[model samples]
Target: MSEKFKITITTTLTLVEQFQSTLSSSQTNAGQRPNPSTNEQNKDLDPLALLSASATALKSHVTKLSLLTLTSPFTASAVATTLSTLNASVLPSLVTAALLVTPDSHTAAFQSEIRVLTNTALKELFFLVREIQAVAEAKASKKSLDQSEKDTVTLAAGRVWDACDVVIDVATKGVVGFVVRRAEEYRDLVRDAVEEIEEWDPDEDGDEFFDELLDDDNEDRPTSGDSDDDDEDSEEAAAALRARKKDTLRVLKPIAQIYPAIITNRLKLVPVPLVPSDVKVLESLMRNLQQIPEHIDEVAGALYEEDLQKYTSQVGKTKDCASRAINLVVLPWAAKQSSGDQETVGDKFTTWSKTWIKVMGEVSKSIDKT
Candidate 1:
């Protein structure tokens, strides 16, 4: 590569790596001193607009870099200019705009999502830059460009385009839409768990039945001349084990039915432009909601193993998660209401909590019966 071209590439790569390092260490806010006037001006700045503009600019740069031809006299200068613009201007602006909106706790998750999307785009850009550098080196060394080398650069550019498009699309969705989309993802997971439970048949494996027949055959052989009382006891124990397995599955079905309802109700209850003061409670509620699918898996596994004790324990934990999530929503909203409104809100959520608890109660009853 020419001296100027090498310098530009090195500087650009250094800047991109430094920025990525800063982001990885959660230090994006490190040097951002509070400027009241700047903050006031930024109120009307529109982060989404900035994001879209930056993504567009980055895409344009990637296009220029990807189109560089070995014979073109201006290829080196074009690469240098594009890299300089991307490293010095577009990326920093995009990251700053993304971080600017993240302080609003209500939209923090969505804003974090924007950061993630932006980071992904940056990564793709970095990869493309590296690919361009490789091409520059090849040209410098008078190496003939192989078809694979050409394809690699094209593919890298395509990825950058795709990544930038995703960032733009997500920015267009804004915060409320993003949150709703995430809730939909959670709902799908819970629904999947419900379907899995519904379709599961304990006897499909036939391990217990086969074992029982083997035991029966062994009993008939009577190598040690076991008493009839011993044989009767063995049969009764096997029957009891089968009965317990059936009861556990029965309890699991109803509990599985409750998860979708909880997720749906949560989506309805979540306030848009969430109150900043309630962010922590809302975060806790979201955490619980996210764990529902995993908890369902745990309880179902315990039930399948016919470990009634473990099943009862896991069910209790799941019930607590549901109850706490409901209270997080209801109590915060109700606390902000007048006495009569509070009572009404409390009643509404109490009814829902009761139904969940009642279904969860079946596990205890099943355990006791077993």
Candidate 2:
């Protein structure tokens, strides 16, 4: 709960006579104001009057925002700026806003996004809502947010989470462009494929539908708009497949990069505190990675005939990363408990070299079959 907007008339009206103005608070932004020095005070108005009158108006606006959320559309287009400014250290109450049943594509994408939200970011979001409610209530009550207000603050936490859910749903359909740009800038190394697909176009006919699927600099090279009418259907299908294949890969690649780190806990894979959904998301990423073999074969075949060396080298790198991940995971114990001279970096590398050769035999087979 927050304070009510109340003013004590300690000074006589004669001193600030014009200050007894009407109070009409609404959710609208407090737009630009006339300068205090230049805006002529009404000659009859007391100087003390301006301060209390403005406080009352500010209260009304706060109340309107809370009451009107579900009914009145937020006509204030830029409230997003306010939401964006919310500080990040407050821990949110973990009450479910709604039990939503969504598509897996959306589910998986949202889960990944949620999984990556740093603990600091999550806490900040929850706290930011509380801060807003506190400020709004303070303006209204002339007192601080109280106990029942504290419980009511739970409502705000729920709303904040609902907003996050919306962001996730929008992103799963490849809505990452708008979502990422607005919310936060992700780490550069993590956005490799996404950066590429944002520049790609998927229609052979040069339709804007494929042209603008992502936000990035467009390549102007011509596509096959000249394909015959008889072959158009097949061409369109192939184009659609190409578009989907690339975008999905872009969506999934960063997820793949973090897997080795999290699973092996190489960077100390600690459990995320939010919910059990974190585990489910990781499981799905693994399930997707298992399917990467399917794509690699087709893609490798496409590349192998043209450049066997390139295909051979890619398979080698994939195998190497997997082997290192497994070896490091099993050997962190050595680093954790480095007994005397046995704990040197050179010794650890030597152990991993042997360990990988012994464990990743299937990796070679997969590359061979390719």
Candidate 3:
């Protein structure tokens, strides 16, 4: 285990060094750009984007390494060492990337995106750390090997649940921030449109018909503020505009929720069972996952009604947790592996582990999107 850990660390450090080299090159390239304000700066390859990419590469490598051990029979110490290595060697780059992206202005959406990405990455890091810490505490008291292993696996699973909870919390808050900012932008956009329409002067543009109509109206109309029919027409136009605004809000609200909806649904893919303990952990995750859409609605209700309640109810299914897990993934996988009911447990376990890695890939992609 120690030899393997050393090899893994060496390989990871090599990757980190490569990343550092690339980042240095990118910074130099970015500095050479003549214009910093326009899309040309993007052509120069932004350092923050390169940093984000490097963080992603590092995350992928770590996840792959972790999953390799997690799928197999791994000791608590092994997982701990792996996580600690990641925390020490890889996280600095990720933190640097996040800090570099931190802005004095144009920050809300970008900041939320960075926060969710980094927070998601940290969730996995701290989760393994917690499990390792628990295991160490248990071992210091000299617990039985079997008991300690079981406790470690259980604690690890619980830590995964905690990580999922963190993802949910961060995602919910990110979505809320996104929604609030978008709502403000939409409000301002609508206000500006209305103001522009109201401020239009008939004589500003060469509109012959409008100018002729204005001249005729000015000559024929009475000086009394507005006639009863004109007042009624104006009221109807105002009512129509108000109705359109309400309709626009209704449409925009649901549209705004689509990103969060995709994110929440993608989170369902995160907790795949590595061990039996993980099955329970995933079940716990499902219960909370069931509430995510409702939570989103509750938070965004002030902005506009999005009617995500139905979607919330439809998460996974109304069936029992074990049944759902079995039905959705385990059974299907088992049947696929079966050759006249002679399936190897090892192969089935590997398949299950791979499923977890695949889910983590999905979560990683979602994080990138955020």
Top candidate when judged by lDDT against the true structure: 1
Compared with the true structure, all predictions reach lDDT values of: 0.68, 0.36, 0.42
Distance from true position, residue 230, model 3, in Å?
29
Report residue 76 deviation for candidate 2 (angstroms). 18
> Per-prediction TM-score, please?
0.75, 0.27, 0.29
Ranking 1 against 3 by TM-score, winner: 1
Candidate 1, superposed: residue stretches over 4 Å from native: 27-49, 69-74, 101-115, 141-144, 204-272, 330-340, 343-370
> What's the count of clashing pairs in each model shown?
0, 17, 0
Writing each residue's lDDT as its tens digit, candidate 2 over 168-286 gives 34323232332233222222323433344444444434557655764245455335673465367767766655644453343335334434443334323323221334334433433
- Give lDDT tens digits, candidate 1, residues 27-136: 35533444677678786677787888888888887887888643344378777877778778988887767656554543446656776777788788778778888888
Arrange candidates, best lDDT first: 1, 3, 2
Residue runs of model 2 more than 4 Å from their true location after superposition: 1-159, 163-306, 333-337, 340-356, 359-370
* Clashing residue pairs found in predicted model 3: none
Task: Give the CA lDDT, 0 to 100, for residue 125 in model 3.
Answer: 48
185-288 per-residue lDDT for model 3 (tens digits): 44344344334434433223357898688878786665455677776876675564444334333332332332233233322333321233333433343343
TM-score of 1: 0.75
